[model samples]
Target: MPPFSRVTVIGLGLIGSSIARGVRAHMTGVGLTGYDADPQVRETAKAIGLCDDVADSAGAAVTDADLVILCVPVGAIGDAAREFAEDLPADAVVSDVGSCKESVVTALREALPGVAIVPAHPVAGTERSGPEAGFAQLFHNRWCILTPPADADPLAVERVAEFWKRLGADIEMMEPAHHDRVLAVTSHLPHLIAYTIVGTASDLEEVTSSEVIKYSAGGFRDFTRIAASDPTMWRDVFLSNREAVLDMLQRFSEDLSALQRAIRWGKGEELFDLFTRTRAVRRSVIEQGQDDAREDFGRAHD
Candidate 1:
């Protein structure tokens, strides 16, 4: 049985459109509705036939939905939820694709006091934005972490999990704060580092912008891909999860300083051991099917 017969996505960006496409591909009987704050985005979604109906307002979009997924930035989740709170069906299950769970849980609870909120983070995506960037396969084999509140309805949580599973995701349950801390180490910190590295390179006085681009190596290129992610979304993520992100950042800085000291003192054994352990970690990630094991990360050079 399908988890939801009527689904509404309240943002028309990559994630939102991908959900629509995934549903159309996997759950053909389910109805899909979509809306975006930007009129241009809504029009684009309509042009692409991204949803059965493209609503002009958030309230109208979710009126008949059994599942409402907010694909908006983390900073806007509360306002977006509040926008349709009055119009939301009494039995609807509200979920979101926000990276930071603790803040998102607090915001959703505040905005929709009686709603069955199931905050989710589909740990998947690429350095792309807008409806055109979405595809049905984005979530295939990806982890979709669900952080439902302690008081949340059990059936609602299970339905949300099944919904993602139908869309080809593996589901895991987690506490909101723990989800935030874990993601801070795995996703948020890496993005922060990428942004800093790319920005520092751009701002270097000795390196011309054109030269930096022209001489980019594989490592720098990968960092640029991560850094190219949606700025508004990332900005909201960092601010919303500041406490966890800062804790991880502090630990990373200490480790970085230690590495600098080792390099300065020519501690070859220390550096070698660190590199060996990190390499083993990368192999484990590949072994667990988290990434490609092919040479150069499966890149095709034509």
Candidate 2:
């Protein structure tokens, strides 16, 4: 059976719409409702049947929901919660899909005091957004990490975990602070590097926009894919998790300096050693079914 029959989702973007569609596909009899701050998004969600209902307001969406998932930028969790705070049922378990957990947990708990807040990040997405961009299979084989507050209800945590599991995500639990620190290196740093590299390519005075587009084949093309992600979400993620992201950025800068020194001195062995280690990491990801080893990172096939 599904963990929650009446599920309400706030913010009908890619993640929110995907969850609603996933629930519809995999969990029969579940009542899924959705609402977004943008009226156009609400209309799109309804047109696509992303949820059973596209509510006109956040409070109306969560009126009788047992599970409420806030799917918004990391910095907007509190504001989204406050939008429907008075309508959330006492037993409704509040959760979120914010990449940064520590700040989101604090915001959710503070905004919806005494409510069950279980922060989660489904480590899965494409370089897409909006209701029309979501698919039911987006979470399949992906990791969904839950970072519940210290005093959060154990039952609430389990229920939220179960909910994600039904959506084909592997559930992992950790503290909010630790989750933030870990994602800083794994996700935030990579996106930051991608954005920087892509921006540099675009701003190069010697390179024309047409030339850059024409020559993008391997590495630059891949970076552009990541850089094409929703800017608002990435902006909020970096700002909300500034401390951890900055820490990782510092480490990345030091490593980059080492690489620069090695290149300047023609240290082939050092470069080869690091390349081999990183290659093994990619192999591990493929072996664990976290990604595909096929061309275009499985994009062409998917």
Best by TM-score: 1
Q: Per-residue lDDT for 132 in model 2?
A: 87
For all predictions, the C-alpha RMSD in Å is 0.8, 1.5
Candidate 2 runs further than 4 Å off: 299-302
Global CA lDDT of candidate 2, please?
Answer: 0.91
lDDT of 1 by residue, 155-205 (tens): 999999999999999999999999999999999999999999999999998
Q: What is the lDDT of residue 255 in candidate 2?
A: 94
Each model's lDDT: 0.95, 0.91
